[model samples]
Target: MAQPKYRTHVGMVDILPGEVEKWQAVERIIHEEAKKFNFEEIRTPILEQTELIARGIGQLTDIVSKEMFAFERGDDQYVLRPECTAPVVRAFVGHHLEQRGGTQNLYYIGPMFRAEKPQKGRQRQFHQFGAEILGSDDPIADVECMAFMISVYDRVGISNMSLKINSVGDPESREAYKQALIDYFTPHKDELSEVSQNRLEKNPLRILDSKEEEDQPFIEDAPVIGDFLNEESSQHYAKVKQYLNELGISYEEDPHLVRGLDYYTRTAFELISPDLGAQDALAGGGRYDLLVEEVGGQPTPAVGFAAGIERLLLACKEMDIELSEPKSVDLYIVTIGDKARSWAIQQLPEFRKKGFSATMDYAGRSIKSQMKDADRENARYTIIVGENELNEGKFTFRDMEASEENQLPLDEIYGRLKKKL
Candidate 1:
């Protein structure tokens, strides 16, 4: 037989049992925080119509241009979703959810696909937890999103983070800035990396985000977006900063933070930590005000942010945050005789139904071996059922943690454990 051609590769991962608890605890915190902030959960298809992403997310962006996993199905082509906002906007329009003229706060936690060279805390397929607030352009809304993100990090015990923000400006100002960027890079065109050189012609703003060592010096000297911000964009950015100040949220204005998405219009921001090597962004998001209108919804204004779960988990490990302890077994049934074994088996379901994490010696080992196994599993209570005890309808209950033992009738065992547990 031929071996399978595609085995698990470097960029993929399988979450094992020992690590699953941390993942679950993180997810629980996300949900709890989202609920506290009044954001409703929304699920979008993992596979989206290709054009939805190509148009909604921007064809010039790396995610749409190079990272997407595209395939054909019947008459239509589809791509695995690379981000959450685009599909959520599609759903908002298709469902006419805002016809009532109200607002929607949506949150999603799921896997996002991107075909990038894997590194520390990054994978080909990674999961992101995100929240989007649509239908409001209030600068306070932007601050709220930022605050919520910080709160989530705090809840997860991640500290030593710096918040960096920038205003990408509305389409009008962005185009003007894009022209300036082109003119600035035009003279240094030959010095730019091949990837950046290509970006210069398509989306010059993306050149600022280039990671190539060769592009750094040139990108640093390029025109700052803050200098070119028009009146409306300037005021919007100022108000956002003012709100952050009011909330006592410390932030640094980074003119270079053009988030890697075409949909972003104004107010792009990232939460960074020095602990993460090259890719230090623990969470990132920004305003995509024109996205709804760009994608055929009524001029809806939106802002949102996303944090990588794996990266956040790494941060927890680096910061030494403890995850919730594993569940403890309440009881282990140890049987010494065939009749006692039969009786123990009969009593197992009732013990479980009474809300106890119970186990029994399925190996039918000696009582000594069973006791050792029970200790290894950290069973809180051990019930010994030998021939004499079974004949008397009584059992020996030993407390592993307290190191105490008691005698109990089979009929009273459930009630006694209920009180003790």
Candidate 2:
């Protein structure tokens, strides 16, 4: 094989053939399960206003500050969306989806762009699918969102995943907590990593989720968010756990489990898969009750979760869960001689119009080679178009799987194929 003149950019992948089957398999499960939970699929443009992402995800957040693929042209600024939940909410508020609705349950599946260097399961251009239940503040709504998050993994045969849950508390509680974190870490600021140092004053809660080795010592002793939760936030957080327990969804409480994003509040959860090795997180999501109101809508409450499609499929592969087999063609047309080739090309569409997946030799290869092609493609049946069969007004149809051949007219072949199918 010759190398192509072009290649995919860094931090990207070509999900060709065998691997794409797994993606399709996973995607189908996602659609079916999402619909089962009353999630309406919504597609937003991959390009969004830069301000929307900065404002929605928070300016101090890593995604907005470091990982965003954004640009400014003239007076206008545009960005490739780094996450879906924010864009979904933007569309909801922009399109007035609330007017005709009650608790709009929307879901999205598409690619997101970030400027970060790619790793095993992380990509600069990665795909994510998530569900957002807007207009509900009930902790049971939080429980349902979390359940929906793990439903795909449950059905897809992935195993050995740990559910880690935490509460960042609401705004009022979070403010006092931020001050506590600032005061606690301020003295040790010089000893912390640059990232952690920057986060100390702007948003101290982010330091808790830092991955820096040096920062870990300081983060280890920092105050937990649960300690600062007010009466209302504490009640809401307790209800979320109660519901999870009732559903038999076992979870471990983590003090520093604040998700990477700044929008999350009250409830946060991560599904960890040991199969992923170093980058072991399967998915992370939490409550963002202030998101809708932040985006110029009324003070509507919402909860959502986002999972990396690449990461999920990676986990499936690591666990040796066979998602799908190689796709096989229904019919392969093996043509010999000029006249027979013409006849095959003419009738191929008719076969397809009637819903048969048919393919033919455009190379005009030898009959021997054409037959080999049919075998290679794993075709279920091979129809030989040749002088003898063409003159007899019948075709040599061979059942590739059975290694049996028979002389059959077109209608008979169609009938037999339909019956077998």
Candidate 3:
């Protein structure tokens, strides 16, 4: 038989044991910071009807058009959600949550999917920690959401980020601005990429978000959306900025900062870390006044943001933020003879039941080798259960750090370690 070929997986990743501690630390900070703002956790399925994303997230945008992992089941096509907001809106409306609501503050942390080329801080399967406030149009709500994102970064010790803000206006104002973009980009259509050209005809506003360097000057000189904002939208945006100013939150207005989603209107902002090379955004979101209604709900105005966990972690590394290393084993039980090995194994369940993390060497190594292994585990203490010690109903407790060893009765071991932990 020809030699069997083994191929490694592509476009997918498995987070291994070493990376898990970083993920846990990130989740801990996210949960702690979100709770401080009274944001309740909300979870939506990974699979959503394809149209839900197509309609709400914009079929023209990269997420819905190119990146969505869509598959068909029976008659309906479903997508592994590339973003959180659309599915959340579907859950909010389908459950009729607004009927009971003054306003709902919701947060979510989980995996999201996109079929894109994986790069540093950009993966096909990645995680996001996001918070959303539904059924409120108050600009303070916008500021609060921005502040919450900033607080998470600060808590994680990520620093020196720039906040970029923009206003795309409400329906009426945007309709006028769209025409201006179409007129400007229409003349320069041949000079633009095929994707930009298509966007120019369909949703011209998306042209502002194009990263093509050749497209920059034309995009920059294009009419500002703020100038075309209607009175209500202009005031809404102004009030959001006023709240940011009063709270001493600094931000720069970027006319091109329209977030890449169909739902966003009025305020849009992104917290970016420049140290992250090309994919610099750590977190970004904006006001979505039409999102609830877009997903077949009654007219509801909502605003929220999603922060990329991987990007945030990258920012932490770039900033040299010292994340705590994973908590060490409370105690490691080292055994010599076969009898002591069996005894140590039985004692593990008891130690863990009492809320202490305990482990024993299963390899049946020599007593000296086991002690070395305990040291490698960064164990607070090691219990040596040699034949002699086991016969005496006692074990030698060696403090891994202090190089101190003392004998203690097996009955008193759990109690003694509990205090040390």
TM-score of each: 0.93, 0.96, 0.96
Report the C-alpha displacement of residue 310, candidate 1, in angstroms: 0.6
Off by over 4 Å in 1: 1-6, 99-101, 410-412
**Clash-forming residue pairs, model 1:** none
TM-score of 2: 0.96
Q: Any idea how many clashes model 2 has?
A: 0
Q: For candidate 3, list the clashing residue pairs, or say none.
A: none
Which lDDT tens digits does candidate 3 get at residues 1-421? 8999975445567777767788888888888988899888999999989999998988788787689888997998999889899888899989988777688889999999999888899788888988888988899889999999999988888767999998989988888988988887888889987778888877787787777878878887988888898889889888998999999999998878888787899999999989898678889999999988888998888899999988887888888786769568998998888988888889899989999889989887887888788877889988888789877887898888899988889767777777777
| lDDT computed for candidate 3 | 0.86
For each candidate in the order shown, give its overall lDDT on alpha carbons: 0.88, 0.89, 0.86
Q: How far is 375's C-alpha from truth in model 3 (Å)?
A: 1.8
**Residue pairs with backbone overlap in model 2:** none
For candidate 1, give the lDDT of residue 232: 92
Clashes of each: 0, 0, 0
